[model samples]
Target chain A: MKSLIVVMALSIATLVGLVCMRVQATQSGKNQESAVSQSTISSDSNSELAQGAPANPQTSSDSGRSLVLVASLTVFVLSVFVGFEIIAKVPPTLHTPLMSGSNAISGITVVGAIIAAGYKETGIGSFFGMVAIVLAMINVVGGFLVTHRMLLMFKKR
Target chain B: MNALVPLLYLVASVLFIVGLKVMSLPRTAVRGNLLGALGMLLAILTTIFDRGVTGYLFIAIGLIAGTVIGTLMAKNVAMTAMPQMVGMLNGLGGGASVLVAFSDLLNTSDHHVDTLIAVGLSGLIGAVTFWGSLVAYAKLEEWPQFKKPHSLPSQQLINAGLVGLNCLFIAILAFSHNSAIQIACYLGIAISGSFLGVFLVNPIGGADMPVVISLMNSYSGIAGAATGFVIDNNALIIAGALVGASGIILTQIMCKAMNRSLSNVLFGVMAGGGSAGNVDEIYANVRSTSPDDIAMILDGAQRVVFVPGYGMAVAQAQHAVRELSKVLEARGAVVEYAIHPVAGRMPGHMNVLLAEADVSYDKLKEMDEINPTLDSVDVAIVIGANDVVNPSARTDPKSPIAGMPIIDVDKCRTVIVIKRSLSPGFAGIPNPLFAMPNTLMYYADGQQAVLDIVKAVKAL
Candidate 1:
């Protein structure tokens, strides 16, 4: 019941935001400002949509959502434990290259988002979902690509 | 399509875990990152239709607007302020999450006590992180100086007082679930976060932007994760966790890069300001070398390691550097790029730069991995980078960066500096590395100098 309310509220904001975005274009002259505005809209759109109707039963509860959470949590715990085991001795020797590589991972999200967002699907929700996916894609892909080039320094000897 | 959400969630989570794990290893890190990113994309798409939509108007507008702005940011923002830009994005991310939490609060009417309470908590934490990041962004770009009151009667007390009142309002949220209370909390936290943000970052010097960026990034992730709990989103939960874990790791890396503990940096607790002797005057006749002189040196070298810094980034000379590397490689001289932990304006700043020029991922080397090779690397090309390559960390006790690890570039057969001026780097300390016996200064813009060197090598 509460989840539905949250989704409904989000949908209203997204609707309002979409309308207000027309104003944003006219009001803000800067492109980044509009980009910020775009993020503003999508941030609301999904939550609103998620709460509005019967979301995939899987994402609606912790018990059902346990798979991904379990995977991430277990890894997080292991990383913490392992990281501590090697604490202060890791020497950060691999930090620069690793950062570059992870940043590249952040870049790869762009491809997925592009695929989803650029196309039109039967459901309007899916269509907008695709768009949001595209935006997310840009963030991930761009971030990772940059990272790869940075870490290239550590390749071999 | 409905089942797609869970499928993608599982996939994204696995990728995130694998990507993060693989990123821990240098050789497969890039590929791991790419896979994780693909997972995130899948999660994002799943979440999009998680909310049912009636029209495509908003979607279309968002795509167009975000694309245009992101493009401009990519094209226009100078490389020197990339950290600030990255911080700005974090602020935006946290800010949106906070606002979404607030909107959820506004929508509550029939009084689902649990939901209202969750949203309130999410809002408070998210607000702090979002607004806090905004202040960090401003400091990195507009004000690169540290600021703090030498003696404040009760700085901590005042902030605590405001936050206490904010918590009082949160109690009301449990009973009433009112938007008005939500408004008050938002205002309270906004003011408090602004103060906390200034207090946190203002005392930090410009040299620590990477840490500041990572810390802020951590805050952003926490905010998003908190919001996930409020919304009960499987995708949000997973995405937020990935971001949070990665952010925490980034902070750790950033802290290590500066050779300081995160706790020490955060509490205004520092070991030393810097090595004073590093700045002590030394008499040496400084002479500038032209592109031809550098070319001759490069041509004769058996191996070369090009160390790109913010100067190289400002020069936008990645292509020339790549071409020069190819030239050296053709002549049977091994070429590699040396990346310092904190070499550029932001974390991974140098990597992004070189990739923009299409340099392959196979030729870069980490500081630790390459430092041992300086003894054999015939020439160490020092571009616009400063502090990371500075030699004082090893010898000076009074210096701020004393005891911090730095590249052993001075150990190389010869060092060539490509810069436009003698101005000090972020640390405001003159590099003795520039005046070492085998070091030669090439006073020119990085791109022009590298291009010139490429031409000179051709002539040779």
Candidate 2:
């Protein structure tokens, strides 16, 4: 009984903290806005943005690029962590519904990649862009197909 | 900054891919969203470094305004209204992405015809998804449209023509005497999208909106990601892709649960004579139970399964329901929760509220798992959910819900329904479960009624 009380108290505190974090983000945005001025802006406004942006110098620009490249690769690899977590915890019955719905959103990635490819100027860029489009297409087509299968659950016949 | 673009895009693409994959499952979809968000955050941070903070003050204000509205919408929106909220937000995402692409095109003076065409296409699509999704949202929320079963096939034809015409605008804008064509395309996008929104939602009944909402959410995410390409932003692309994929999967699942297709759920929408008033007229129902009778039902139960829905949420009966459950459990009866996927306004809505009332997560069982136990349970107490526990889904093939997955509360020995009135559910179908011989109807406000049940159980 005592433990239940403690848990209840903790849950309330967690809810409050989440709400506060949300409020704080809003407040911070407001504060930042009042700090800016319209008169000080220039034609090459991108320059101003770049100036104050992440001043921590990329330790050896070449190495920095390599580090970002490595980080990007690691990010993709971490998706496996996501994979393991979902399949293990999800109840078997909900698998059909959840998968079909999310698959539709996956279709958007293909559409995005297609537009990106269409805009590319170079042969290599276009080739990679085409690859992006194809991957996105696969996601879109596959998602729709899966969704169609799930709809069979509701069929009258 | 330029060198990082490729790597950043690669990471964004990966997040987009994985996020969609994870969204297919209810359990991990939330985690999938968080992971996709992290990838987008990385993309956003990278983009900001190279971005010229053009009119930084306005940008800041816009961001602040968007955040405030978005947060309020997220926190306060009811689960029942979740589908509508999803539709509105999706529309906003698509609209904003199109706006971003348009701004980019307008800022640059150089006439790269290919780039112009791409931006135009992106803008047109973004606008269409935005306005169209809004109408879809309105329909889900039951925005007071008087004409029932409204249909407009011509609107669809116009929409198709408008999209093609917008592409033509790009080609003309590339070598036109003035920028009128581009402006006209924007106008057409706004009009067509708005019209399409009405047409899409006009025929749709309230019942199938959860599925449509999920689908619209996917459209919104895809629009945002596609727009990201126009602006060459890695983060937006990743975030948009994640949201889009997950939305699709969720929509598919909802359709399956409803026994409908994405297309059917959207376009095969129907609004017929409301089943509630007509049923009440058809069968002169008699009140067979009082508060005392309800107390007796509670007194005799050895096991109970409580099913809650939007009506419970509307009643704000989480606290009272928890107390009632506790009282029943103390009476040496095993109590469990039957959580239907589409029970409340949104996914896990009842669970979240129940959790808020300090209900143990272990007590909640998904519908399929709980349905089997219903037959063995002495009593099933349905707080406010109607369609979820309806026997029609199981016994009658001609019923509106027919093959849609439902909790087998009809199998229970005794059933009690506490509701405001005999209002039909979002499915717009009458619940025969309410009229079953074994079931007792005690219509009142859910919160007060649950509290009464608690007191009755305590007296027992």
Candidate 3:
């Protein structure tokens, strides 16, 4: 178990490092693709700060776990409303691409699948976790790639 | 490290909402997709680093295999096959949730009632979404066995029974503490739910597919949320809830467009036993016209509206349509594209196809915007569309598409329909618009017909 944990930790760290490098590469590549678009991306990300509430630190207290669970439920409820509100006024023409895009976002279950695969002790749990991870990754990767490919065609003018 | 985990998830959640918000406009949609992808990456990395996870080999293998398979499929899939692809991927998403939620339940030595309930619900919803999505894919791709609506005798009763059995199994598992019994209950819930999924989606006719697909998308999201509760992951919960709500809204929009309720869509078994023999009678009235003669009609027309449907996608005719529109515009004819809300297999399907052909966004007009002034338009050119423009939608109360809103092409001075045959749409009902006095059927492949028209118009 200890060996597995060490190997897992090392691999995760390495993967994270690789991901960061790839992100940097993409950012540079994006800049070269279009300076105007690059400016818009940076400006859009900054606006995220205007939304209220960073993570509530109280979730980490000795209630052991349910506190975090409760906090999660709260976030879940709020996000449903936000999701509806954000997309309410979308024109009919964008309904297809937008739905496909959001379907990709729901593949966020990859995070849970990864955690399940990595955190379990028994072989059965690990096997199911691996399957889950693969499926979720497929959703995430396929959903995003297809969406991006589709979006590339939606040029103005 | 602890503070960082929640903070990262929060950031991820914010990014997802922002991404979806900005995606409404074509200009920022690509960036929105990128932001969402980045958010997913952050959330996954944070979860891996949090604690207790140790199966690096499995994670690595899954990630690599998934990335390769997903990338290949996404890059290779043609735009015309996109609906089936989306349906297939949605099934994968649901399948993942089912496995994750089931495994988590299996690993649980100490049982909480709430956890059991969550697991059961997730398993039920996930299985339904998974199998339902598969059926949707088959239907869309026209798999022989699934091509027609497959319904049991008294389908509503059977579906109700399946639903009841699923709830009963969940209740038994939630109350039972015995491990063996609980496992059996879980299996029961999954099997019953899978059967329910097949039954629920099988009854829906092809015309109602957009709604079914949208609803299945919602089911997957709801299932993911239930799984999040089982695992207590904030990112999964938030993201799943967002998709769940958004999908339901999209489904409602489709239903409204079709003038049907959710129940009518799911349980109505709409296709029934309509005779196929009448198709011959219907087509006897179709009058075929050459592209040159139609071009002559367009030579003097002041306004022209192009209505495109699934046939446009099949024939890959958007570019031809765009070119033809440009020619018409240059000839001092006002040209615009009228889009029915449920025009194609998926929402905004026509827009995506047109956008790909570099059709100016403003030239595409929604149904309501164009319907009011359709009578003033000199020519309405329908490319491979059927039900969405059928006059039966407004005139015949007994028609399957009765009360559904459609592009008012019939009211236009001259209606030109470009289609291969006088075939019915998904509804298996004849379109009266094809035989109307002003309507001219240009029987040809959508692409060939449009290209020929473009050439003919150029010659004129």
Residue A125 lDDT (model 2): 27
Per-residue lDDT of B1-460 in model 1, one digit per residue for the tens? 3334444555665565556656655566556657665776566555455433323454456545655655555456554566766666565555545455554443323223444555565556555665666666766655534232122456557657756765766666656433455456655655565555555565566567678777766565555555554544433444454555555676777778778888667655444342455344531545568888888888789989988887676677888898988899899898888888787655666765665566655566778788887898899888888888888888877677887788889899899988887777776677778777888898888888888899999999
lDDT of 2 at B32: 53
Residue B353 shift from truth in candidate 2, angstroms: 3.7
Task: Give TM-scores of chain A for all candidates.
Answer: 0.34, 0.38, 0.55
The per-candidate TM-score of the B chain, in the order shown, comes to 0.82, 0.83, 0.95
Q: For every model in order, what is the iRMS?
A: 9.6, 14.8, 11.2
Cα error of candidate 1 at position B187, Å: 3.8
Tell me the TM-score of each prediction against the true structure: 0.69, 0.68, 0.86
Name the candidate that leads on TM-score: 3
Q: Ranking under TM-score, best-scoring first?
A: 3, 1, 2
lDDT of every predicted structure (CA atoms)? 0.57, 0.54, 0.78
- Provide the lowest-lDDT 10-residue window in model 1 chain B: B143-152
**Which wins on TM-score, candidate 2 or candidate 3?**
3
Tens digit of per-residue lDDT, candidate 1, span A1-157: 4423433443343233334434434444333332232222233333444354312221223332243234333433333333223222223434443433333233322322232233233344334334433343333443444444444544433
Identify the superior model by lDDT, candidate 1 or candidate 3.
3
Candidate 2 local Cα displacement, residue B183, angstroms: 4.5
Candidate 2 stretches greater than 4 Å from native: A1-157, B8-40, B51-55, B68-85, B109-117, B136-180, B271-287
